[model samples]
Target: MTGLLVHSARLITANSPGDIRDDPTGWVRIRDGIVTATGTMEGWAPDGDEVVDASQIGGPGAIITSGLVDIHNHGGATFAFDGSIEEILQAVDAHAAHGVTRIVLSLVSAPPRALEAQLTRIAAARGEQPGILGAHLEGPYIDSDRCGAHDPAALHPPEAHELARLLATGVVQQVTLAPELTGGIEAVRQIVAAGSVAAIGHTGADAGTTLRAIDAGASLLTHTFNAMPPVHHRVPGPIGAAAADDRMILEIIADGSHVDRTIVRMLFAAAPGRVALVSDAMAAAAASDGEYLLGAQKVTVRDGLATLHGTSVLAGSTLTLDRALRNVVSWGIPLGAAIASATVVPARAIQRDDLGRLEVGCRGDLVIWDSALVPRAVWRDGVRIVADAVAHNRPLAAG
Candidate 1:
């Protein structure tokens, strides 16, 4: 049986909720693409056919954590996920460079036929690529007032035919729509019944409507506070309603642009263990500043911020999980907690417990980094995707 071992590394992982064991000097063994054993420096043994000496790679402060799982992302190649299989693979390689081992490909607003076509393509790729976690439709049923980068014309009430077709594909794992739409709450109920996550976002719904959706089994809030009404002292909006609901999983983009660092920390405190940091990245991610297409919408990327062309409306983002972890740590959050937000938190949000964390039964996906939070190597399904850092000399530099 082929095996690999990582020894003398700082393992930043949690055995369970509230049981984070950020071991300083730890070792983990992987056999047949699953973690088989783990321990600290006490009585380490070289069992892997291959070994990674974290100390030699980056010396002390070398940290290892379960690979990040991005639950919301449009695309990352120069092109978007709304492309061919090869383009999707390009995006996968792009984000993998930034330590994202698992991803739920996001699709922007489009006609039902268009979205369904894209979804079918992504569904096929999901089977081909273990890293792809299926599709997340972020539009076609969103509130026009807060559509963000989505096309207002494409936004409409969730129809049963469209909903039924999507569920039949068995490709959609999540749907983001305004609960105030006609039949929205009923759609939420049906979405949950069909084994898909119902999320509220791009919404102008009031607190009451938001809570009703939660009662109807809507469990996630998309990019909290981005396209939704904020917490008003008089009328608490979706953000307020979700903040008070323990059953809601809040998706926060920690890129420091979509959300401020201070507010992100406040949300982390407000939601406790229920917050999942998502990139919401578009095609410009892992690339230089340029223009890109996001679901027939033109977007400009400059200085890492993606916004609509000829307008100030912020588009998705150019964020990657690695940069998100660095941003939070720089804000004074503990490294272990920050790491969990990018890793385990998002995994659990998507109900993929088999992907995150370093345990005997979990997938052998992880990132090796330094004290500065720079990813040196990334492994997906026990295969080293990022063999080495070409920019190792520029370690710890903020993007």
Candidate 2:
């Protein structure tokens, strides 16, 4: 049995909710793409076909964490998920370079036929690539007035037949819909029945309506406070409603533009162990700034801020999970908590408990970070993907 061992660095991971463990001198062992054991260096014995000494690789504050999992992402590297399989792979590789090991390909609002076609392609592609977790439908059933960068013309009320057809594709892991539509609550139930996550997003639903969706089994709040209404002391909108519930995992786009970082900190406090940081990125992510397409809308990304071509409405984001991890840590979030938000929290949000943590039986996916929180190396399925930084000169100063 081939194995790989990494030791002599900090191991920060959450085994269960509020059960984060941070070991100063820890190690993890992987065999055949699955973590086989983990503990402090004291228990280490001779093992593994290959070994890495983390202290020699990453400087003083080197840390090892599970590979980041992004549940809400449209596209990156000048390619959108709505394109052909080749383009989708290109986007996946682009994010992989930035340390995202597992990701859900998000598709913006489009006609039912177009969405179905894209979903079918993703289903086929998932077989060829284990990293392609599945698809997240950000909508065709949402409020037009709150449609951020989605084409209002492409929006529609949820139809049971239409949803059944989409879920039948078997690749739709999550569906984001406005739960206040004519049949919204039933749609939530139907989505839950199909074994998919029903998330409330791109909606104008107030607290009462949002609570009803929660009752019907909607477990996620999509990019809280972006396209939806703000938290008013009087109204306590969807953000307010979802924050109060322990069952709901609130998705936050921590990029500086989408929501204020100060507000993001508040959300973490409001919903401890319940927030999942996501890169709601479009094609502009990991690519040079320029014109891009998010669904049917034209977007212009300048200085890394993406928005509708002629309007101030944010299209998606230019964030990657690695950068998101750094952003929150800079905002006073403890490193362990921030890492959980990017990894374990998102995986649990979609019911994929096996993908995001460092434990026996979890996938062998992780990132090695320097003291500055910059990823120095990435490994997936017990194989090194990024080149080892130890082979180079002493680490360069992080910006």
Candidate 3:
């Protein structure tokens, strides 16, 4: 890669309140695929390499935010996770065009043999793609009652040997399981011990059981309200427990179907900076209304709503993080808070300190949006990956 110089842009750091420093005429320098320096136009000048004038692309009101980090997603475009390696690459490229720079490929519940084979393939393909972060196993050990679209036959208690083997692959970055299931609490400890984040999801655990799981080291609540039991005056399920815990990070799918707008607002108010907006999208994302396969089950997409072919249960979302950000802001969330949920909070959830901020020494992953908050250009690791060059290199396929 080569050096890059970005000039004349409004930078939104999403770091602190004072971090949104305006620069009618400022410049940011990148060298060796990292942000080196940023300052006003008078203090910095481009010496070599490529120079990008942000104003020329999106004009004065252009908004610049950190490249989004989606830690959980099953598929996008027409590619499903269960497909071949070529299909995975196609999915990664599809999401990259939408300003997602880092993504954890979330896999639904599957048999041990199938899951291991998929993990091995993903491990082999790491670093070959720009934004393929790692794998997120969201299954095989969860409550059968809350399985949602996952195949219930594959649900079982987490085994120590099986989990050790999955972690040993070095490709699994996050795992979601129900704590109330057999051996579930022990599984949380084992997953945490392997340096991977253990998330609580697809669960039927009550408040006490949820608290115990948190005490055991599960730090994430996957898709907060969709798979878990609903909050009631007497029950106060996992959602309530997560709300009361300060150390937990809650994931919300803001597709407007999986969660109510009012409920999303309440979660934002309750969690403050701890909520991370995730897509939880499957193969239907960025694709048209049609039939699609999620793991072993079939789903039908209608008006962007995906559901199991014949059931009322929602399968997953067809949302992208950029659209989710827009939805939150549309629901009266502050732009800064909404941006933080999509960027900083998710980055923090995965314990990635270097990303989700535009400070010096951080990776130069950024997106420039027009006044309407539509992406105009996206950059990953100081490299301009989206523009006329990108369009020519890889034209987007029609959804």
Q: In candidate 2, what are the lDDT values of residues 131-158, reduced to their tens digit? A: 8999999999999999889998999999
lDDT of each: 0.84, 0.89, 0.83
**TM-scores for candidates 1 onward, in order:** 0.95, 0.96, 0.93
Q: Could you tell me the TM-score of candidate 3? A: 0.93
Clashing pairs in 3: none
Arrange candidates by lDDT, highest first: which order? Answer: 2, 1, 3
Q: Could you tell me how far off, in angstroms, the CA of residue 90 lies in candidate 3 after the best superposition?
A: 0.7
How many clashes (backbone N, Cα, C below 3 Å) per candidate? 0, 0, 0
lDDT of 3: 0.83
Candidate RMSDs in Å, in order, are 2.3, 3.2, 3.6
Preferred candidate (lDDT higher): 2 or 3: 2
Candidate topping lDDT: 2
lDDT for each residue of candidate 1 in 232-272, tens digit (9 for 90 to 100) = 88998999999999888899988777877888889988887
lDDT of 3 by residue, 291-366 (tens): 9999998998877888999987788888888888877898888887888787778888888877777768877888
